[model samples]
Target: MRIRPVGAYALLLDCDDPDHVEAWRAELCRRRDAGELSAVEIVPAARTVLLDGVPDPGRAAARIAGWTPEPVTTTAAADRVDVPIVYDGEDLPVVAGHWGVDVPEVVQRLRDTEFRVAFCGFAPGFAYLTGLPEGLAVPRLATPRSRVPAGSVALAGPYAGIYPGASPGGWLLVGRTALTLFDVHADPPARLTPGTRVRLVDA
Candidate 1:
């Protein structure tokens, strides 16, 4: 695991292989449980884990380096949220055709595999999801869209994501879900926080 101390309280660990996911997670979990790391939160993505909370970054990183944790058994614990979707995205057929699968089959695959918010980026509440079916891992459009409607379910760069708010984007849109993902008035403002679990349902 390649570790970097980010800011005052976060220890960033970058993993080179998917096989290292559990091993890296186990180390962090051990430190957190033992109170070796006073992290306010722990955020893990496809290739990285973040320990958020500490008085000093240097001290935290040193402390973490000394403790060798037991092996870890990694499980996605991603919440299986069912989001109703409309199969009317402009690129739905193109994606299905790209994978040589029918439209219904594409939708089924999307809804069947629960995805985790690998990270939130490009916009608030827009979560990059992992666990996309191998068949559905399509690339982004060559040209970006000027504005994608909110709740648009899309895929790009081996990751899936929902459009939280209108913005220019290049992801291949597979469908549109009715779920409202962002609201500025809400307590947290963004519906999809990092580490959220999600699944789509054809409606």
Candidate 2:
């Protein structure tokens, strides 16, 4: 593994061990919670983890090199947030048709409360949710949309997300919600955090 500086405060880790990213992430979080590291953000991605906030990037890298992080506690991440949805999206019927199931089934699946905030990115406060029902896995359109309204529940591949704000998107839009996933007035801004659980509810 190698740590490359991203800027004055952030560094990107070129992690070779693909399967251990989550383990490394948990460890980093543990260190942060214990006040062992002066890191502000330790974000894990598909193959890289971004470590940020360091007075000296080299020292931070050395600290990380000498130490290993632990996994997040199940209790701390146990609670799930219910996101109310209307289940009336433009792509709802089309998604059902592709799955060979009726729209009602799609509604039930959307209402299923067995998903988690896999990660957050692509947009501020927009979380990449995982654990979608296996049969409902779908692909993005050949052409992405010009604008996806905030709180638009969408699914593409094995991931699901609610657009925090209107923007170009590729995921199949399934529904819309009125909930605010991001708020500039809030201290942290991003309403959904990684490891946060999500339960979709029919409005």
Candidate 3:
């Protein structure tokens, strides 16, 4: 891990992988909760974690430099959520053809795999999920739809994601879920947060 100064206040933790970023973010949160550190936000991205609202970036940098991280593991006691999906997407056959498999195989592959919310981006409540096998990674659509409906479950590159609200998208849709991913009236709006474990169950 490398700590780099971000402007005058924030520090960015450059991690090797998503696992390291998540593990390090969780560790920082632990420190913050224990009163060992104070920060306005410890934000995570695909390969980097940002410590915003830092009081002393230089001091924080020194502390993080000496800190060692434990081995990263998937079963680190995180919140698990099951999302029900209807495997009736327009791109079902497209993905299957790309994978050289039938439609049912596509559904089975998604149902059997365990996923985690790596980070949220693109739109509110839109979670970029990790844990899809590399063999199943599909490319994004050649032409993006003018508007994708909310609750659409899609895949792009190595990540799987849910469309929290109707918007334009290019990810290959594989299914649809009934769950509301984002709610302004609800506490903490987004249901999927970083490090949260998720599974797609059949609807």
Evaluated with TM-score, which candidate comes out highest? 3
In angstroms, what RMSD does candidate 2 have relative to the true structure? Answer: 3.1
Error of 3 at 136 (Å): 2.3
Which portions of model 1 show Cα errors greater than 4 Å?
7-10, 17-35, 40-46, 66-78
lDDT values for all models: 0.73, 0.79, 0.89
Which is superior by TM-score, 2 or 3?
Answer: 3
Q: Rank the candidates by TM-score, best first.
A: 3, 2, 1
Scored against the true structure, residue 115 in model 2 reaches a CA lDDT of 72
lDDT, candidate 2, 1-203, per-residue tens: 67788988888877654335656776778787888777877887756888878767888788888875554344333477888898888998878987899988877877864676767889899887876656667889889999888889998877889999999999888899999999999987987777677888876
User: Any idea what lDDT model 1 has?
Assistant: 0.73
Q: 35-115 in candidate 1: lDDT tens per residue? A: 767777776667787778766778777776776545533345454466788877788788888789888787777877877
TM-score of each: 0.78, 0.80, 0.95
In model 2, where do residues sit more than 4 Å from their true spots?
1-10, 14-20, 56-78, 133-136
Worst 10 residues of 2 by lDDT: 69-78
Better of 1 and 2 by TM-score: 2
Which wins on lDDT, candidate 2 or candidate 3? 3
